[model samples]
Target: MNSTSSSDSNGPKSFSVNFNQDASSLQVGCRNGYRLYELSSVDSLELVYSNGAEDSNLVERLFCSSLVAVVSLTSPRKLKVCHFKKGTEICNYSYSNTILSVKLNRSRLIVCLEESLYIHDIRNMGVLHTIRDTPPNPSGLCALSINHENCYVAYPGSSSIGEVQVFDAVNLHAKTMIHAHDSTLAALSFSSSGTRIATASEKGTVIRVFSVVDASKLYEFRRGMKRCVAISCLAFSLCGQFLSCSSNTETVHIFKLEDPHNSPRRSVEESSWMGYLTNYLPTQVTDVFTQGRAFATAYLPFCGVKNAIAIATIQHQLRLLVATESGVLYIYNIDPNEPGDAVLYKEHRLDAVPENFDKTDKGRSSSPQNIEGILGSYAGIVKGNPPGQMSGTESDKLREMAAAAESPPKGAFQFSDDQEYPPLTQISD
Candidate 1:
């Protein structure tokens, strides 16, 4: 959970917004306290719980369950796990430094500080493992998989570069390292199935997706190259077929991960001219053609504010949800057949509690209290790339090929279609 000051002068003082593991619920922490909303409906949010006893800067709901992890502004160094439905604090832990972020799954709950992380068993709220002296993560940049079986956690492996270290939280060991980018990583997220992870560097230009099983580069999408902006969030749809990225800019980019074979075909004339000039052009220019572009984009009513995004299916319609720190949630309708701008459908002010809210109605989330039912399984494993398969550096190869031959190298144009990686699967519309 990260806090950002409200950019709108008329908005609340300061707040933070975070979606639960599945985006089925949203938690907004503010100076007053926090509010939890169930997003099962597209037109309105069902106010599940609200409390103003203490100011909270971080609030993470455990996948629509009764549990929630909270960090208060008055006590930044402490973490409180409470059963929001019961209004009872289950447990609280204090740290040596201010808590930067807290992530939770059904099996594990991780508390991240500036230089260390504590992994706790969610069943009992007891410390199971400690990762000390990790690279400095001032923003507490880390993600935990919702899948209880695989239970992979990813954090920045290096302070200078965008290297991601995936750890098997269940087995408690290092899984693999992925050199995602040259710049420091700004945001990363796991697909619902945990088979793929998306990463965005501080540069905020190109977004890359890697196979969790082998740490191989799967798809690279170009956001823009004009000016750099801070990326606020990276989210994979629940179906794992679409990835949504929100930045400081007004636009939210949605990239399709569906297999190209099943996607609606486009005429070759619609392709960019750069696609045919890859061998003759510089890597920087060819990179634009080689990478995938956004399948759909949605414009925000406001800009320059930190926001989090999620893609979900609501009443059989694909909707993109954007929650900004300024205390507003925007819902956009995405057309599967269109490859352009998404239409804004609805907007709700998170701070506005519904008139007929019922705080005692725990029946909405009245599933079994079992950990397996709350978390659900959706994760996988990954190994290092095989020999001779370049994990990075497309520019170096292009430069060498330019100096070496008059003709294009053997496979200079087939970057995305390389047989080394498995083809991406398409999700049914």
Candidate 2:
């Protein structure tokens, strides 16, 4: 799999023959400007997908190890959210031109574009409402996150007591703004049951988890080392027994919120993708990221969907884009339900792609494309990531406790041509 780069920096790039793991009987659309490679090695590896099909000069590839959803975003602005089962397009939602601030439930997505917040339903790629709580600023929409009922999310001009501004996911309306952090807040998360909320800011490094019902500080955790290090990302475990946070330190901290009286049990872990950039991203281009430094920080920071958190960084360095709007993708296993080592299992990237992919009338319309196939199956779905063996942390003691039993990490989703992960049927366009 050894390889080297050529002078044609932003052009056709290759991967180490060792890492190529596309399906064996791979085929390409003759009219499509893409090709698939088969790696004799890496048997159980997920089928690596490349996206330079439209044009070789600009290319992108993507792969998912767990719950895979088909979504689309335009570089210039507008975002198209789509939900797919096997290979069919279920429905797509188009939102106004703005940076997609947050995507909550599979069907609940918040796109804070331009001067407003848009509630879109991937159920059929449609926009429910365009709520303009605050006027748009040149800085662009900062950030947003939705709650369980798809009700509220944190918004701008928020206050110390105002942890998050609740929103009506069904109708774009001003729900309520809860008094939260002491300083300019950076990120927010609602406890699983929607009974509590957590806030962090430039001034507050420790995440102050408070009860939404009483607006009382339930517990506080000291986060990062630097100043104004707000909690960049946060999420609660499935059973609502633990809380996890990631920061500018590029570290993922998992906390066992098992002990109600005591603080939540927390552990710190780093991303494993740090090496891939050197392993894959740097080959095509040399700028933006140094030998090891990725162009962008990992993102979504919290993905409970796969019972794991996802990290979006830059990659396939050959064709690089400096826009903060562009980033890579990676996933890891941090099951709050499980008691054991925080395993950072899967890592992937959305290959270096061109801006107008689905933009022009010609290509796939900024709307992502899918192969027609099944929705799901029992064979490929990996199961059992948590047991009851582990518990507790130093400062934040976990209150939740269970019996000692363990389950294996879910196997990678297997994608094949005939019946890719059978049972996963397309929702419907």
Candidate 3:
């Protein structure tokens, strides 16, 4: 899901900042503004800087704009969004009660308040629709997001018991629901492509991935040493092959999923301490960058899938640094000429300033549509089982055989539903 604002002709003064685009260049953004510097060689892009205050009316909290639109309502005591190039006011709609969560879809508007979930049409300003599509007396929503293409909607729920659900973002349909844990679900996120889903819960920081087609659980993860850690933020790499999520305890866990099929790469960064893990796995040395003290996550758009990831963490003096959980954000540079595998980038934190709208774009379509396709042929079944204690070899083989026989690669199945199905009579959603 995404939080976006259009720019008007008279927005902030336009600046043509030419970037190195190479891995060696350093870029930064923060309370101050944006700036660039060279890696090994001493050089700077000496542009006049602006320390602007943040936009007050803008609220989408956490913004992840790939194919899906992801936003949250956790800070500022109100909804807030990431600042965009044009601007950062994704939606004009407001709520009467405390906003629990917000999701910016490519084609729809979905928000979850303290007690219910809502689906709206981005095209018409009027209420296109509403769905209390959750269990009654829902404690509240912690996180929310739509797939990159806005095909499905996901939200984390932790009420009397904890759980998470993936629904048809368009029709408010409950396609498949998982009774994930005996505890509450802490976070919900989707791969940038909208093909995979991840949910972290209090049940020992277990991160579960599911296929979009059947909404069935696929890969099971035992990610880190932090126990009972709940996820605070999630960011998918541009290529969708890697996922970065941070927890309250100043720990970021990077899980690599197999490309295309998205099968769990099976190798999770078991610990945030980067320097030593490299001794065992060579390619995984990158995990060291995520070693920051804290994080406010925002994914950057780059050409590669796993290379570009931006995370913001709160420091003692309100400083922000871009890092993966590997601690590499601080010392590692993508530049070959830079010293060490660790390259530290900079962040721009100007004196909080409101965005100048004179040159921003605010043109919004009455109805925005990001329908990739109706979910079809996507199916998987996961029964509650303790983490290890696998069935006997014979049983495991049988299970694998059964799984192979029935479960084809999920992408092969197609959603044949005509989407045009007339509304059901007296819909009780």
User: Mind giving the per-residue lDDT tens digits that candidate 1 earns over 305-400?
Assistant: 888899988889999999888888889999876889999989888766676766556423433233221111100001111112221342243233
Steric overlap count per candidate: 1, 48, 71
What is the C-alpha RMSD, rounded to one decimal, of candidate 2?
A: 19.1
Among these predictions, the greatest lDDT belongs to: 1
Greater TM-score among 1 and 3 belongs to 1
> Could you tell me every candidate's TM-score relative to the true structure?
0.80, 0.47, 0.48
TM-score of model 3 vs. true structure:
0.48
Ranking by TM-score: 1, 3, 2
Give the alpha carbon lDDT tens digit for every residue of 197-298 in model 2: 666665635666766555566666555445734344565543455566655343455555544333222111112343344456554342222211111122
By lDDT, the better pick of 2 and 3 is 3
Residue pairs clashing, model 1: 213-382
Q: Estimate the Cα RMSD of every predicted model relative to the unseen true structure.
A: 16.9, 19.1, 18.6
lDDT of 1: 0.74
lDDT ranking of the models: 1, 3, 2
